[model samples]
Target: MTGSTEASLRVEVLGSQHDRNSFECGVEPLDRYLRMQAGQDARKNIAAPFVLVMPDGAIAGYYTLSSTAVSVGEWPVETVRKLPRYPLIPATLLGRLAVDRRQQGRGYGRYLLADALLRSLRSEIAAFAVIVNAKDGNARRFYQRESFLPFPDQPMKLFRPMADIAELFR
Candidate 1:
């Protein structure tokens, strides 16, 4: 994969057999959570984690996503009136995404992100958008560049509508 694309790498749903003790993404919380808590979260139906694995079975990167919602007030009044008057709008939460330090510059972050979006778009769940709670300014920028817009009053949180994502697959 050195001189080629990541076409050979595959994203696997995290499971008991996958090695989690050795995954190190250079971020304490991300690494710790993946090693110690992602499984529990998945078991509880809170969020599902996916890991990118090279053919040799090394963990390259991972991301977690779960069902969530946004308040109608999070959007502009014009948009609110057009949607259901429910207190919350359905969404998929891209909770966390991180690349192992060794795989940092190989575009695995983007790869994982594209995979997450594709999964969200393909799901039958009722989601109006895919949302992310960016950890910092840099994280926010990444999502913004990927076409996720900031909610009306939140700069650190962003979202891309499901309709927009659906258009990509067509």
Candidate 2:
């Protein structure tokens, strides 16, 4: 498609028809997960992988969402004080996210992220936030730019409250 833009992209559940082999975001772990484990995870109900598809059916980017939990103690005191006294808080894990190397600079990462957050917010299951474990400093910075906050003790692990994310879409 000529004059293509991110708006022209569509996000859908990853399926056998989607070509995962050619998706490379210059990250080996992320690439391998998508190509090998993503389908298995989906089948096992461990995670739901969504792919950003071009008009020609090429996979430009993908992300996985799964149910998770975090200890209340892991949250900052200021944040935890307002929350329930439960030992663990429900969350949605953004397990893996990556864009094809060719699509890296085209804003597909953020686009996939937005779609993931919105999906989490819309889910009937209760989740206080969306959490991500950044693979490195650069990934951490990326999530931080999108308003994700690093846990006080775990800089690579970050979260953005569902309420705040809801406000973003509104």
Candidate 3:
């Protein structure tokens, strides 16, 4: 299926033979991590992965969403103080996001992210925030551009309030 826009791309949840092959070709590191998670029986903790395929049927990129828990202490004090003294809150984790080297600079990564956030918004799992551990400066910058705020203690990690993200869909 083609994307709705001119730079048409298809985004689908990962499954099946074709999806596996596309994931391997596009983002082997992410694929390896997913396999490891599956081997460790941690797949139950994660939402399904999704992949973006170009019109030519090549995987352009992929991302995975997962249910996660975060302690109130982990958040900024300003945000934490507003909530009741619960030990932890349910959160959504963007576990892996990668683009094929060949597909880099084509805006497929942005497309993959937009698709991921849209799906997350529709999920039944309760999530007060979306969190990501950015792998590098470039990755960090990408999330920053999308309005994700850096964790005060861990600059490499970033988060977006679910309310802010929801407004984007409006």
Best by lDDT: 2
Model 2 C-alpha lDDT versus the unseen true structure? 0.94
**Model 1 TM-score on a 0 to 1 scale:** 0.93
Cα lDDT, model 2, residue 43 = 100
Candidate 1 lDDT, 132-165, residue by residue in tens: 9998898999999999988888888888889899
Better of 2 and 3 by lDDT: 2
Best by TM-score: 2
Candidate 1 vs candidate 2: the lDDT winner is 2
**Residues forming the 10-long window of minimal summed lDDT in candidate 2:** 1-10
Model 3 misses residue 135 by how many Å? 0.8
Ten residues in a row with the worst lDDT in model 3? 17-26
| lDDT for each residue of candidate 3 in 11-98, tens digit (9 for 90 to 100) | 8765543344434534456767544553243346446677776777666777888888888888898888777788998888988888
- lDDT per residue as tens, model 2, 80-152: 9889999999999999999999888877888899999999999999999999999999999999999999999
**Candidate 2 Cα RMSD (Å):** 1.6
Instruction: Give me the runs in candidate 3 sitting further than 4 Å from their true place.
Output: 1-7, 19-28, 34-47
RMSD of 1: 1.6
| Backbone Cα, N, C clashes tallied per candidate | 0, 0, 0
Decreasing lDDT order of the candidates: 2, 1, 3
Per-model TM-score on C-alpha atoms: 0.93, 0.96, 0.83
